[model samples]
Target chain A: MVSDNFFPQPGGVESHMYQLASKLIDRGHKVIIITHAYPGRTGVRYLTNGIKTYHVPFWTIYRETTFPTVFSFFPIFRNIVIRERIEIVHGHASLSNLCHEAILHARTMGMRTVFTDHSLFGFGEAGSILTNKLLKFTLSDVDHCICVSHTCKENCVLRASLDPSMVSVIPNAVVADNFRPLSQNEIDSRRSSAPGPPQPLGPNDTITIVVISRLFYNKGIDLLIAAIPRILASQPNVRFIVAGSGPKAIDFEQMVERNVLQDRVSLLGPVRHDEVRDVMVQGHIYLNPSLMEAFGTVIVEAASCGLYVVCTRVGGVPEVLPSHMTEFAAPEEDDLVAATNRAVAKLRSGKVRTDLFHNQVKQMYSWTDVAQRTERVYDSISTTRSFALIDRLKRYYGCGIWAGKLFCMCAVVDYLLFIFLEIFAPRERIDVCKDWPKKAVPVAKLGEEEDVESLKEGGVPGRKRNSRHRREKRDETDESSAA
Target chain B: MTTLITILTRLASPPPQTLHTHQPTSSTVTYTVTTRPALTGLCAKLGFYVGISARVVLGMVAVLVVCLKWCVSLGIGISVLGAFWGEGGERGMRRIMKLIEITDGTYIIPLAILVLFLACKRNYKEESLTIISGLGLQTSTTSSFYLRSPSTRFISTTAIQDIFIHEAFKGFEVRFYLAVVVEGEREVVVVFPSMLPRRGILEEVWREGRKCLWEMGEKG
Candidate 1:
């Protein structure tokens, strides 16, 4: 797998890649990641579930995406591909220059390529136009394109002018074990400590609505700022826990102060991705007023934690969960306020079975299921004969009247470059690296054990399995270097 | 910008007649001015031409005359607005420009470039990548790219290696522009300065160079 967004940088794409890679590794596939180096996380490293990641040192331009110097990545990328003996080079996130470069190089090396589009982009903005053209060029001959939702698929098709059949809608999955609701034992312990049966508040108990996302304009923080005061004024029992930090965070803080509702709104700042569930379970409702989203994985995570969701109807948020699991709102402030009001009423009436949400969400989305589907994509691509050089060029040629020809020329040159490289550095000279140790258990057993382990370790501050493993590995490597 | 605002609001806002109550005419019979469907279609076609006329005219000027690209782009933009949306063509051109601006910047410039690049496909001995490729290549300790022939030496970067692909693109024609690979004090700089039509070819060459990288990688 290749991407620019990865660990040390907390984001949707980063988490998606990590979770997917780990899940794929659990399914007995030797998954490795190739991403640009991040601060203090350079060179090769091992992540949880025995997933190896190579952080190639490159100059990051924006948002951790490296500057796209097309052919410059060839040498290092070629090294990594050869070392791992990668067959199918799956790339994630459309905005990643590393992903595009990897796909182009993988195809040149006669490897199958898959690209996953994680975000929705419109064709209007100058940035979008340039991105779409670049996307068109890269996706022109990609074996297949995976989109997080049907809406994303439609957007990708329109932007790249690709055939509908080539694009598949695979919704992102949340690890239900990590996002489980408060267990009965925990609730019992809490009741014993507080000496009251979890206060089914009569008429006026505070209902905490949680908003956990980067406070960015595209996230509809403006709409959230507009609606928060109104929602508070209308519903006396509601308070808020807004946990995230972004450029728009100050705006939210300002709104809370301006409305003098600072007491009602609690800003937790930026919480780690793993601690999101902890923040989520404290709330009665999850408020997502994002103006745009591709899959809205956080909503799924919220539902898994047993919070009633109130989100705007945009991008693929509508299709993520059932209408019963959520209250839909338009992007407008008035509509959001109205939606929040409805959710607050639903909570008061006890119409939503929040307790049953954890189990339902578990059944709906699982990393194992996602991994299985991805394996099928790999199976299909491997079984089918790879597109011939001429065939690939022809496909690229249909991109645009001029773009088609340009792409064709690119493909032809890439093919020639491949031939030249074959003569210079033969495949026989490269050494295949040994694979990481695989568990002896069956794939199904491994998956089930992973879920059980994750569940057992939930909310345990000192368990720190992932961090511990990373620390141990780093220490061992450090000692070895000293020797 | 004000005209843009008015036209946009006029199109989006409710029709003016909808606001007022209708009064019966004194005349016993009403006369209707009918427009033919074909005539309307013809007008729409004419409007489309007018809408795209700016792009077409600008493109012609760019291809026929060699000048600063941005000046041509700006000049043609102004001329198109004046010539196609003059007093006579205002109504139709307004609708076209409105649609263009809203949907996409008329896509005039990009579409024009695409056409020019495609049309200007010529056989050249050497294709060049531009200085922009210098962006990230400076950090790499050892970076190499392919050109047309395997023997074509790239200067300014440490020692370079070549793989001859005989009969590939009838002899591959790719050049890298300022692709720097730093090793200690010495650096390997691969420079390919792509001219107009050659720019497109250079991009193609860059895309094609991946194969060379892959092969040389396998040879390692």
Candidate 2:
């Protein structure tokens, strides 16, 4: 997997890459991550579950996105590809420079390339226009594309002009175990354990609403600021806990001060992903005022934490949860206020069975299910024949009148660079890395051994010794699996 | 103990720089043993001196131009200010010429020679790694000048925990290195850290170094 966004940077795409990689590893697939280096974190490092990350040092120009140097990354990327004997180069995030470059190079090198678009983009903006053209160039030769939701798929298809069948909708999932709701005993113990001024909510008590999004304009921080004052005014027994920080945070702070709602509103600035549930469980309602979202994974997380969700009806948000779990509102101040009030009323009446939400969400989305679906996508693409160079050029030519030719030129240059590298740094000169010892696959799960065999058939010639070692460990693995 | 093998190879960097893997005894190996500094040859020394002189001359000329430009500007400013006080411009021009003479007369040649000497102080000598049977490994980089001793580190045989060929990211590219994991040290001691030969060379050195360090003891 290749992306600019990966841990220890937190976001939807980062967690998506990590969870999917780990789950794929659990399914007995070799997975490694390629990301640009973060400060104090460079070189090769191993994460949980033996996922090796090559933090390739690159210049980051904006917001953790690596500066786009088109062919400069080819040598190192090619070295990594050869070292890992990688068959499929899975790239994530549309905006990631490393992903786009990897996709272009992977296609040039005759390796299967897969791209996952994590966010939605509009075609009207100038930035989106440029991004859309670039996306079209990369997706023109991509083996398959994955989007987090059907809305995202449609948006991506329209923006990139890709064939509908080539795109698959695989929703992002949360680790439900990490976002579990506090048990009744745990909540009672906490209330009795700490003698704080704030107490646990009883029937007809003050309703605590939670807002946990980064305070950016697109996240609807202004709408949140406007709705909070009115929501508190209309609902006398309501409190707000906003738990993120950004440029719009000062606006939120001023809203709290101007309304003199300091006692009721608490701002827990910039909570980590792991601590999200702890904040969620303290509230009766979860408010998401995002102006645009590809797939609102956090609302599902809030639902999993047993908080009744109040979200704006924006891109991919309505399709995430059922009507019973959330109260949807148009992205406006009054509607949000009304929605929060309605959710608060429901929580007061005890009509929503939030206690069962965790189980329902657990059944709704899972990384295992996502990995299985993604594996099917991989299997389908593996069976289909890849495009020839001429065919790839033709596809690039169809992107647009001017951009098409420019893209073809880029592909030609990238191909020439590949040829040059083949002569300059031959494959034999590069060392093949030792594979991480895989977890034992159970006998029942070995039904898809054909894929593994096919991958091994495409492995590097230098990997014979490692394969022999694996063969020797087969019996040990079987014993462990059997036990 | 007797001599086992000797493989003479070139460093991966460039030509004329060589690496020698010599096992004088059965359980000892010395690599990259250069008898003279890289700049010791007559032509190389002449070329080095010429390059340094040219750079120093260019630097001095650049300094002269900059200083002259500054003095001209300062002289003009002083003359303009002096004219307001009924002082003559000849005095300012004389002062600027004296300042120029002070800079150009005494300090330029000595400063240039000092800079040249300092530039020659860089280590243009080869680095070597030596391993003996019971005594551990010693890594050294020879200094170009005799005034400074070579920087060397010796890890005792017992303290030498492990040796392996590893690859890591350096700058924008991946490089192969032979690293020694010394006991109780957090960072591995990188053998041939500066030269950073290719994987083939590092693997050979790793195999030979390990055999000389530990495997021969086991066989005995």
Candidate 3:
């Protein structure tokens, strides 16, 4: 598996990639990640779980998205794909140019490809148009596509114009046990234990609202800034703890100053993910004023921390948490203020059972569940499509008018490159990296053996080595009923 | 120059860099100001207090956001209202929106080439909007940075330089209200606010601009 987002980047997509990759590796699938060089990071590095990662040096255009150099990534990528004898290429993160380039090159090389879109994009902006087109071009010939949520699948089908059948809806899973909410007794003891923490509020104490996200425009920093003053003015015994940093940082700061919320609102700036729980435990409400999302895992994380959620009703946010845990607000300034007020009122009135959110959230997600779902995706691709690269191209060719033709052309060029590389950069000549001491999947006896035999020909890259768990191999073969 | 870079470098993180630890010695009830430097703002404090339309405010903010996000220079100047000189929303009054549209349009190489095709053409058809008696860009002389709040989030909006387009061409002669297409796409409105118009043609000229825009959209 190849992915662009990994550890170091603090976002939902980044976390999803890390969790999925780690889980896949634990399932005995050899996963190698390919991402652009991040600050202070260079060359190939092995993450803790023996997962190898290659960070290619590339110029960053906006945020961490690499400058799109379409054909430039081909030569090096071809070398890696060939060296690994990779039969399948899996790309992650929609914004990563590296991921797009790999998918394009992999398709060109006649390898089965899977693309995972972690974020949802709207059809409205010009930026979305270009992004969607680029997405269309890459996905035009890919073998299969994966989306974090059903909403994201719909978005991908519309944007890339792919058939819904080929796109799998695999929601991102959170490491639920990590976020355990404090109990009332625990909260009181902790407050007392702290030698005088903000004493546990007896229903009338100040309610703390937490906002944690990058201060970018798309994150709706403008809405956050606009609503802060209104939220503070309406509720006197309310305090804000905003932890983020971006271009909108100044805008939020200005709001704080204009309202003289110096004592009331505290900007904690950016914080690490591990510390999110600690900061969240201090707050009663979690406010997410994001403009768009594919799967709002942060809201899940917030709910897991037992904070009542107040979020803009855009993208997939409305579907993330049940109404009991969250209050939905339209993506409008007035609506957001009103929703926040409602959430505060609900908290004061004891109507919202926020204390029960932690256990509920833990039940909703797990890395193991995500791994099993991903395994199903791999099964569907290999079992359903028969390693037939042409059939995969046929799936991609259904993308759109000009996009379909362009994708076929990309696939043809990649096939030609594969033949050329076979002649010049012979696979026999390149050294195959040894597997990291993983147990082999013993070919199961009986009818299950025939299915595994068929999969061997169309196996995912690094899958040929060994299936460490015979249980998973048996469980996956029984896959027709998977959701 | 050093201060500018420092200010920019600081923009990456949110306000209040040093997190307050919940310690016994810490002032839990009383809030103290963070040690962040109170560097002069890129705009005046009172500027953001009053309401400014997206057209005006976004234009001024674009000078920085674009420079940071796109790594390009954009010159935005706004002046008071005057007579229409045919540039219409594309140039004078809606400079911010126009600039965004143009930049977004030109950002793609294919669209850039398309725009280049329009730029090369010499003479073209011209249509008229309402021959306004007076209409101009709400232009303002650019102000240097002043009184910037240190604990701000997102973009530090600079003081607005409103460029108003006068309604000079709002009531004008039919003949003077000419719509000329430059290159392949751009339509320029060249009526001057200072230019005298023929009597009783104002309403006709006003009607023509809308018709022209509608016609262009249909043709496009």
Most accurate candidate by TM-score:
2
TM-score of 3: 0.59
lDDT of each: 0.69, 0.80, 0.63
Candidate 1: Cα lDDT at A235: 91
List model 2 lDDT by residue over A200-303, tens digit each.
34655778889999999999999988888888888788888999989999998998999999999999999877788889999888999999999999999999
Candidate 1 lDDT over residue span A360-406, tens digit each:
99999987888889889988888778777888887888888998888
- Docking quality tier of candidate 1? incorrect
lDDT of 1 at B8: 52
Fill in the DockQ of model 1: 0.01
Q: Which candidate is the best by lDDT?
A: 2
Best by DockQ: 2
**lDDT score for residue A184 of model 1:** 68
User: Where does model 1 exceed 4 Å of error?
Assistant: A188-201, A440-483, B1-220
Candidate 2 DockQ vs. native: 0.13
